[model samples]
Target chain A: MKFSRKTLGIPYGVFLTLFVVAPMIVLFYYAFTNGQGVFTLRNLTDFFTDPNTLGTLFYSLAIALTTTVVCLLIAYPVAYILATSKLKAKSVIIMIFVTPMWINFSLRITALKEILTLIEGNLAYYPFLNSVLGMTYDFLPFMILPIYNTIVKLDHSLTEAARDLGANERGAFLKVTVPLSLPGVVSGISMVFLPAMTNYVVLDMLYNSTYIMGSLIGSYFAAYNWHGGSMIALVLLGIICVFTLLTDSGEDDARTGGALL
Target chain B: MKKFRRILVPVLVLLFLYVPILMLALYSFTDSTQIGAIRSFTFKNYETLFTTDELRSMIVGTLLLALGSAVLATLLGTLGAVGAFYSKKRTSSIMSTVNQIPVINADVVTGFSLCILLVVVFGIPKDTYIPLVIGHVTLCAPFVYLSVIPKLKQMDPALYEAALDLGAKPRTALMKVVIPQILSGMVTGFMLAITLSLDDYFIATYTKPATFDTISTYVVNATKGSQTDIKTALWALSTLIFVLVIVLVLVMNLNSKKREQKEAKA
Candidate 1:
C-alpha cells in the first residue's frame, strides 16, 4: 500500500485538534462558567480583585524574573568560556551541563533541599531565598545552553574588527559579543522565566509555601475548584502568549540559526 | 594567571553544579532516615528501594510512560514532519506555529487544560490510565516535531524524486530514501521526548489517574505529609540515575568520536 506524504499529516492534524486545540477551549469554557454551568465572569473578576490571588501572581512573576536574571549573569560567562575556548572536547563539556537533568528533577530539588537544610537550617523559614536558589539551580543549564549555541555560531571577525577599529577587549565584548548573542539571551530568559512561574514542585519542596501562582492554581484544583483554577490558568496562558510574542517576534531568524538544545 | 582563571571558572561552576549532587550521593549510603541529620553509612536504602513495592512501581511507571510516549510521539511527529514537508505553505505554516504552543506554554496551563478536557468534556473516568498516556504524548510530540522538521529540511529534496523516478512506490521511496536520511533526527527526537516525559511532574500529576504514580509524582508526594524518611531511598535512586547518566554521556561521546575519526579516514 502506498502512503501519500501529503496525507500523512492528517492523523496528527486530527490528534492536534482533539488534544491541543480542544483542551485549550475547555479551559476557557471552564474559566467563563460557574459551578451551575451558567455563564459568569465572577471567576475572572474575583481572581483579579482578590489581593491574595493578585499577590501570588505578582510574587510568581517577581521570583521568575529574579531567577531569569541570576541565571543569565551566571551562565553568560560560563557559556562565553565554553564557546570561545579552543578545547577539542567542548561538546563533552556541554554534555556535562546537561547530564544533571537526566536525574529526576524533583529528586534533584529534594537533594538540593537537603543540602540547604544542612547548611542554613532556616530555608524553611526563608521561603523567598530558598525558592530563588532552587529556581536558579534548576534553570541555569537552560540559560547556558542557548547562549552557548549562539556564542559558538558568532563570527570571531566581528570582535576582531571591533578591536581593529580601536575598541578595547571589554568594549568589543560588551558591544559586539553581548549584542550579537541577544537572541540566545532572549531564548534563555524565556526558557527560564516561563517554567519558573509555573513550577510549583520546587516551591512545594523547598518552602512548602503556596504563595506563588503555580501553588495557588494547584491548590484550587486540588480543592476541586475547577472554575477558579481554570480562570487563573487562562490568565497565565494569556500572559505567556503575549510574553512569547514580545520576545520572539523580532528574533525568529537569529534563534532558528542557533540550536535550541 | 590568565590560563588559571579560565580553568578555575569552569572548575568552580562544575563544583557548584556537583556539590549538592555529591552531597546527595554521599547521603544515599547513609543509614540515617532523617532528612537533615546524617549519622551512619550503609546500603540499607538501596536494599529497601528494591524491596519496596510502591517505590519500585513508581520507577517502572515513570520509565514505561516515558518510553511509550516517546515512541508514539516520534512516530506521529515523523509523519507530521513529512506531511508538513509536502503540505501547502499556508497549512504548514499554521501547523508549525501551533507546534510552538506546547513547547513554550506553561506546564501548569497545559496540564490543567488537559485535565479539564479529560475530566470535564469527555467525562473520562479520572482513575483510568489512558489520560496519562494521552497527556504525555501531547507534551512530547511537539519536541519530536521540532527536531524532525530540521532534519527533513536538511535532506536533499531530489533524493525522494530519484527514488520515485526509479519506479519505486511512494511507501518504498519513503521507507528507503526518506527514513534513512532522517533517522538521526528521529532518534534525537525520541530521546528528547523520553527526557521531557521523564522529568514531567506537572502534567503527570494532573492527568495521572488515582491508581498510577510516576517517579515525579511519587517523589513529590513522598515528601508531602509525614514520610520524610522515604527521601533517603529517593537519594539512592538519584545517585544511581546520576551515575548512569555520566556513563551514558561518556559512551555517547566516545561513539561519536570514533564515528568522526572513521569518517575522516574514509
Candidate 2:
C-alpha cells in the first residue's frame, strides 16, 4: 500500500476546522443573534447606533493610528541606522533592542507605569499620552525588526547607480532607497497598528482606561453579553480583513513597478 | 557629525527600550513595596519569588503549558507544511489562505471566539485544560506553518524523489531525507511557539481554568490587587527571565556567527 503525502495534513486540517473555522462561524452566529438565539440584525444596528460604541470605535482607531505613526517614526530611524551603519557588533545592539520583547510585557508595562507615575505624579492625569507612550514602547521592536530585515537586504548598488546617474545623495535616498523599502514599512505598520488597536492591557496598566475596542469587548464578555461581544469581535475581524486587503494590494502595486518617487 | 548622529539615534532608542527593564531589575533587589521608593537594599523579593507556593506553582504550570502546546503546534505545523508542499497548487493555496486567518486575526477575538466555540457551544469543561491547549496550538500552529514553508522551499525538491527511487519507503524517505533538511526550521518554529504561549495573556484569560494561572494572567491579576509581596516578587521573576533570554539569545547568535564563519572558510 502506498502512503500519500497528502494524508499528513489531515490532522492540522481537522485542528483548524475545529478551532479556527468553527469559532469564526460561531462568532458570526452569535453576532447576528440575540440572547434568545433568534436571528436578528439588531447587534449590527446597535453597534453603529450606540454613541458609546461608535465613540470607542473611533477613539480606538485614532489611538491605533497615533501608536503606529509614533512607532514608525522612532523605529524607521533606529532600524535605518542599525542596518546601514558600518559599526561592528550592530547585531548585538539590535538584539539588545529586541530582547525586551522576551520579558513578559505586563511586567515591562508595570515598570513603565511606575516611571510615569514618578514623573507626572498621577498616570490617570495623562491617559492619552501615557497610552501612546506605553504602546510605542511595546511595539517599537515589531516595527524595527521587519524594517531592518528589509533595509539590510536592499541592494546598495541601486543607490550607487542612482548617484552615478547624477542623482544627489538625498535624491538617491528618496527615489531608490525609500521606494524599495516600502514593503517593510507597510508590514511594520500592519503589525503595529492592529495590535495597538486591541492591546487594552497597555491602557489598563497605564491609565485604567477601558474606552478602547479591546477592553470594550472584554467588558461585554464580563457582563455575560456574548451576543454583544461576538458582534464587536466580528466588527474587529471585518476591519482587520479590510486593512489586510488594502495593505496587500498596496504591496502588489509596489511590486509591479509602481515605485513612487 | 553624520556618523555621530547615526550612533546617537540608536543609542537613544536603546536607552528608551532598556530603561524600563533596568528599572524593574533594580527594584527587584530592594525592599521597596513600590517602584518609586527604595526603603532598603535587600534580596527579600527574590526570596519571596522562590519560596511562595503559589508563585512557584504558577511559574511551573506556565512553563509546562508552553512546552506542551509548542510540541503539539510543531507537529501539526510541520505536517501541514510538508503535506502542502507536496500537494496540488490549488489545495496548497487554500491551505495557506486558511492558515493566515488566525495569524492576522486579533488575539482578543481569537480567545473570545474560541471560548464560545469550545466552552459555550461544544460544552467542553474549561477546567480540563483542553480548551486552553487547543487555543494556544491554534494561535501557534499558523506561525509554525509559515516558518516551515520557507524551509521546505529552500530544500532540494529532488532529494525526496531520489530517496524514493533508491527503494526507500515513503515514510522512510520523509523521516530520513526530508525531515533532516527542515530540522532547523522546526526548531525555530518550536521556540517561537513557546514564546507566543508564554507571552499570551488574552487567550489564557479567556480559556484557562479558574484556579490555574499562567504568568501573564497571574501578573495582570496580581497587579490589580494590592498583593505587594507577590507583586514585588514578580519583579524578581522578570529579572530572572530577562537574564535567561539574554543568555539564550546571545549564545544562539554566537553559535550562528561561528557557523557562518566556518561556511565562509569552507
Candidate 3:
C-alpha cells in the first residue's frame, strides 16, 4: 500500500489543531466572555481603561525595550569580535557565552540574586537595575549567536570592495557590514524583545516584583480570574504579532547558520 | 590600543556572563546558608542534593519528562518537516505559519491557554500528567520542525525520487533514504527539545500535576520557602548542572569539528 507524502503530516496537523488552534480559540472565548459565559467586550475595555493593567503594559514595554537595547549594545561588539577574529578557538569562546544557557535559568538567576545582594545590601531597592541585568545576562547569548552567525557568513569581499573604492575601515563597516547584518540585528531584537516583555521570572526571582505582563497573567490565573488573564494574554499576543511582522524578512538565512543548541 | 580594546571588551563581557555561575560554584563548596557569607568549607550541600528524596525525585522527574517529551516532539516535528517539504506550496506555507504560532507566542500565554483548553474546557484533570506532556510536546515540536526543515531543504530532492523510482516503497524510501539524510537534524532537534523542557517554568507551572515539580518550578517554590538545606543544596545542584553542560557542549563541539574535518578530507 502506498502512503502519500502529505499523509505523513496528518499527525502533526491533528496535534496543531488540538493544541495550538484550539487553545487560541479557547483564549479568545475566555477573553470575550465573563464568569457567566456571556459574551461581552468588558475585558477589552477594562484592559484599556484600568490604570493598573495599562501601567503594567506600558511598564513591561519599557522594560523589554530597555533590555533589548542593552543586550544589542553589549552583544553586537562581542559577536563582531568573535565572528571577525582570526582566532582558531573563537568557536570555543562563543560556546563559553552560550553554555551558561544550559545551566538552569532559575539557578543562574538565583546566583545573580546572591551576587547582587553582596554588591548591594537589599535587592528590593534596585529592582529595575537588577531586572535589566538579569535579562541582559540571560538573553545576551541569544543576541550574540544570531548576530555572530550572520556576520560570519557575511560576504567579506563587499567590505573589501568598499575599501578598494577608497572607503575607510569605519565607512566600509558602516556601509557594507552593518547593512548586510541588519537581518541578524532585527532577529536578535525580536528574540530578545518579545521574551523580555513576558519573562516575569527575572523580575520575580530578582526582586519579587509582579508588575510585568507575565506575572500579571500568572496572578490572574492564580486567582482564578481566567478572563482577565486571557485578556492580557490576547493583548500580549497582539503585540508579539505586530513585532514579528515588522521584523519579518529574510530571516531564513540568518537562522540557517546557527546550531542554536 | 585598538586590538587591546577588542580583546578587553570581549573579555569583560565573558566575565560578566560567568560571574554568577562562578559565584554559584564557589558557594556550593562553602557551608554558607546564603550566597554572600561563607563559613567553613564543606560538601554537605552535595550530600543533601543526592540524599534528599524531594530533590532526587524532582531531578529524576524533570529528566524523564525532558527525554519523553523530546522523543514525542522529535517524531511530530520530523513528520511535519518531511511532510511539508514534500507537499504542495500552499500546504507547506500553511504548515510553516501554523508551526510558528507556538514558537513566537509567549510561554505564559501558551501555558495558560493550554490549561484552559485541556483542563478547563476538555475536562482533563490537572493532577494527570496528560496536560503536562501535551503542553511540553506542543512547546517543543515547533522547534523540532524549525531545526528539521533546514535539513530537508539541504537534502537532494532527487535522492528520494531515485529511491522510489528504484521500486522502493514510499515508506521504505522515507525510512531508508530520507530519514538517514535528516537524522542529524532530528538529533539536534531532540537535544533542543530536552533543554527547552528542562528550562521551562511557566508551562509546567500551569499544566503539571499538582504534586509534581520540575526543577524550575521546584526551585522557585523552594527558594520562596525557608528550607536552608534545600536552598543551599540547590547551589550544589546548579554547580553540577553547569559542569555537566560544559562537558556535553565540549564533547558535541569536538565531535562536530571532527565530522567537518572528515567531510573536508572526503
Question: Which structure among the candidates has the greatest TM-score?
Answer: 3
lDDT of 1 at A98: 58
Clashing residue pairs, candidate 2? none
User: Which TM-score value belongs to model 3?
Assistant: 0.97
Q: Give the Cα lDDT of each candidate.
A: 0.84, 0.87, 0.90
The weakest ten consecutive residues by lDDT in model 2 chain B span B31-40
Give the top-scoring candidate (lDDT): 3
Which regions in candidate 1 have their CA more than 4 angstroms from the true location? A249-261, B1-4, B34-38
lDDT for each residue of candidate 3 in A109-180, tens digit (9 for 90 to 100): 888888888898898897888899999988888889898888988988899999999999999999899989
lDDT by residue (tens digit), candidate 1, A1-261: 356889998878877888889988888889999999999999989999999999889999999988998888888888999899999889889878756766778888988888888888777778888888999888887788888988999999999999999999999999999999998888888878888998988988886575787887788878988889999998899989899887884343323322333
Order the candidates by TM-score, highest first: 3, 2, 1
Q: Give TM-scores of the second chain, every candidate.
A: 0.95, 0.98, 0.97
Q: Is candidate 1 or candidate 3 better by lDDT?
A: 3
The C-alpha RMSD in Å for every predicted model, in order, reads 2.1, 3.5, 1.4
- Candidate 1 chain B lowest-lDDT run of ten: B32-41
Which residue pairs clash in candidate 3? none
Interface residue Cα RMSD of candidate 2 after superposition: 4.5
lDDT of 3 at B138: 98
Candidate 2 lDDT (Cα, whole model)?
Answer: 0.87
